[model samples]
Target: MRWNNATTGRWTHRLIPNLTPWLQRRHGQVDFYLTQMISGHGCFKEYLHRFKHEPNPYCDHCGTGSIEDAEHALFICPLFVRYRAEAETTTVCNLTADNVMSCTLESQSKWDAIANMAAGILKELRRRERSRRIQS
Candidate 1:
């Protein structure tokens, strides 16, 4: 099957097969982060705080010490535990940055599965954020 389209506006038919070996590096991780728009950092909190909107950097749902960073949203949050479990089922992965990045550099099939899981988590995150906005 095809990969890296519908994920992007245009199809990248020739890029999928060869992208693996490159994704193991820092630059590759950044590329993946940018493409996913979830940097596993405090990007979401910073955006809200930049607008004077979020008030505190602590998570809205988890009440954790850290902000609602992408990692927290995707992996640490109890709210998305079910979704994370679903993602785990795809690879049964331990959910580490190193693991994910290495996986991306290994197999196209695994990478596609990871991409889909990440996209699904982000979709749910967006839904929650939108709902919060509406409620506010």
Candidate 2:
């Protein structure tokens, strides 16, 4: 599905019933909330625009240079390379159905940690912008 706006252009997503549950399971509830906050659906996009960094809204770390969407925020961001690496390591041990289910069931704390980390990274990025502005 796609939604078009005069300012932000187009947004797209998969039309699947399981998408939300899958997101909550994989990324955790805090990440989901942060995604909603950033996307400005609960509020106005214009109001939320201040939170976004410039240069095409891509993954802050990877520089994928596209719209900064939820998937990129959760999985693909190069800034969270350490988190991804940890997840990869955990995946080896937690490769069973029971372990996967346990992880999903206990995802809230994990999500909180990730969300906090992301918030810190974003704050640092904004701080860098402030520094650059001062320098210039």
Candidate 3:
């Protein structure tokens, strides 16, 4: 079942090619940040827009007009560049959406650092989402 689903198709499935290992080795409980990052379901504009909850998919914080998908927000958005830098500095791993699952399984420190980064970014995004709702 695990090998059969390891297709280069869905974003989550691609990142997590082998589900058994990840499920067996994941440290700590899966939190809000991990859930959002892994599942690509959250307050992200791209997700909201896809589900008809948001008017557009563009990131409001970056002003780059890029789709606020999990990959763009976690890996490319300039708004979280500082967070990325700090996480990378601490983990010594170049963070990417594709590698986050593997990196988390590598060590406890890496997991904690990545989790911190994700939590910070998502919390800020959630705040912005609420602000956007109030403004609109």
For 1-136, candidate 3 gives per-residue lDDT tens digits of 4444444348788678787878799575678888888777877899999888889899876765688888888889988899899899988989887787788888888888888988988988899889888999
Taken over the whole model, the C-alpha lDDT of each candidate is: 0.56, 0.42, 0.83
1-136: candidate 2 lDDT, tens digit per residue:
3223543423222212223455456445545434543343322212234465333444334555534444443345565466545544544332221233234444555445444544554454446556645876
- Quote each prediction's TM-score: 0.63, 0.37, 0.88
Model 2 scores a TM of: 0.37
Which candidate do you rate higher for lDDT, 2 or 3?
3
The 10-residue segment of model 3 with minimum total lDDT is 1-10
Question: Whole-model lDDT for model 2 versus the true structure?
Answer: 0.42
- Per-residue lDDT of candidate 1, residues 1-136 (tens digit): 3346545323122223334455444332333433554333323664566667666667777675667765566567787677657656776577654456455545555555567666666777667667877998
Candidate scoring better on TM-score of 1 and 3: 3
Q: Which 10 residues in a row give candidate 1 its minimum summed lDDT?
A: 8-17
Backbone clashes in candidate 2 total 0
Query: Lowest summed lDDT over 10 consecutive residues: which window, candidate 2?
Result: 9-18
Pick by TM-score: 1 or 2, better one? 1
